[model samples]
Target: MAEHKIYTMSVAKVYPHYVTKAEKKGRTKAEVDEIIRWLTGYSQEGLEAQLEEQKDFETFFAEAPRLNPSRSLIKGVICGVRVEDIEEPIMQEIRYLDKLIDELAKGKAMEKILRK
Candidate 1:
């Protein structure tokens, strides 16, 4: 009897939203996996160090140029105004902007008037 050798794919399952979005964009499962791996590579360690050194998000954004104006990664643009931008700093900006809008809306509610 001969022993059989099998090669299983090493890609891990990511968020369903990612899979769905990737599929909707016409990307294959393999391509999506490769993109994920490439986006989060060994450079994560270096990014962590820099993130620690510059605790402020804006400061970090300023220092990390590659992740600032833009970085054309397999996933998307790493920053700037590009449609594919997926940088954390840009996400944070969006979040804060939403919160500001919510706060402004809360302050503009009309008060009920009492009838005599």
Candidate 2:
């Protein structure tokens, strides 16, 4: 059997990278944060607190205040794996965020991006 490694990367470490990628494509960090809020239901303050504390992705999602139910409607292949094909709920949530970031970077409008 293949060995499975643990996930320990902090969201704070990755957040700036996401911001930079989106900014390179003309998207703003606020826009990225907005989509993150939409997915995780973290208030701006709550999200910032998580970043300030250097929370891991596992804890970030596990501790999300509210996960938007509409996020499940997002379906597509990301990184060669179908978003809907992910069997784990937390993994699904993470992929949902990734998909939203991709859409944001692609210039999709906030309303449509939020699936509103």
Candidate 3:
């Protein structure tokens, strides 16, 4: 089967949208960054490096220092698909991030969004 197009897309390409979504909803970029760090285990500096490098989603995820084990706790529909039901691991990871961002945009408390 052909690889999903999203796998090759740069995470940098989408990061701004996530930030904007949150910002429009009265959330801050730091909150978006925190959610990303919590899910991908990338430090603020490391996350910035990945963004600067324009790494594709596959590479971004592949090189993550430690994908949060608690990411599995993220479950919900994003763009019409339930994240937990996604069969592709990379896709699931992508959706997990999307779900978290969605929650942040929806004004969920940071503690709950981080699953703490």
Candidate 4:
């Protein structure tokens, strides 16, 4: 199968949507950044660098310093598919981020959304 277009799309292109989704629901960009940091283990500076470099989702994930193991615990339907049911590793990771953003928009507690 051809690689999903999202794999090639720059994370920088999609990142603003994540921030807007959270902000529209009254959450701060900091919260979205926190979730990304929690999921990918990128320090604030490192995260900024990733954004600055406009890395594609594939490379963004591939270069993640330490993808949180607890990400497997993130279970829910996102875009009509359960995140845990995604067979492709990269797609699953992408959906994991999407699901976290959705939770934040829905007003889930930060700790719970972080799976603490």
Highest-TM-score candidate: 4
Model 1 collision count: 0
> How high is each candidate's TM-score?
0.27, 0.92, 0.98, 0.99
User: How many clashing pairs per prediction, in order?
Assistant: 0, 0, 0, 0
Q: What is the lDDT of residue 39 in candidate 2?
A: 90
Clashes of 2: 0
lDDT of the structure predicted as candidate 4: 0.97
Q: Residue 107 error for model 1, in Å?
A: 45
Instruction: Give the residue spans of candidate 4 off by over 4 A.
Output: none
RMSD (CA, Å), candidate 1 to true, equals 20.3
Q: How do the residues 1-116 of candidate 3 rate in per-residue lDDT, one tens digit apiece? A: 89999999999999999999999999999999999998888999999999999999999999999999988888889999989999999999999999999999998999999889
lDDT, candidate 4, 1-116, per-residue tens: 98999999999999999999999999999999999999999999999999999999999999999999999999989999999999999999999999999999999999999999
- lDDT-based ranking, best first? 4, 3, 2, 1
User: Which residue pairs show collisions in model 3?
Assistant: none
Better of 2 and 3 by TM-score: 3
Write candidate 1's Cα lDDT for 41-71 as tens digits.
3144544464345434333334443432212
Model 3 stretches astray by more than 4 angstroms: none
lDDT of 2 at 63: 96
Prediction 1 global C-alpha lDDT: 0.33
**How far out, in Å, is residue 84 in model 1?**
9.5
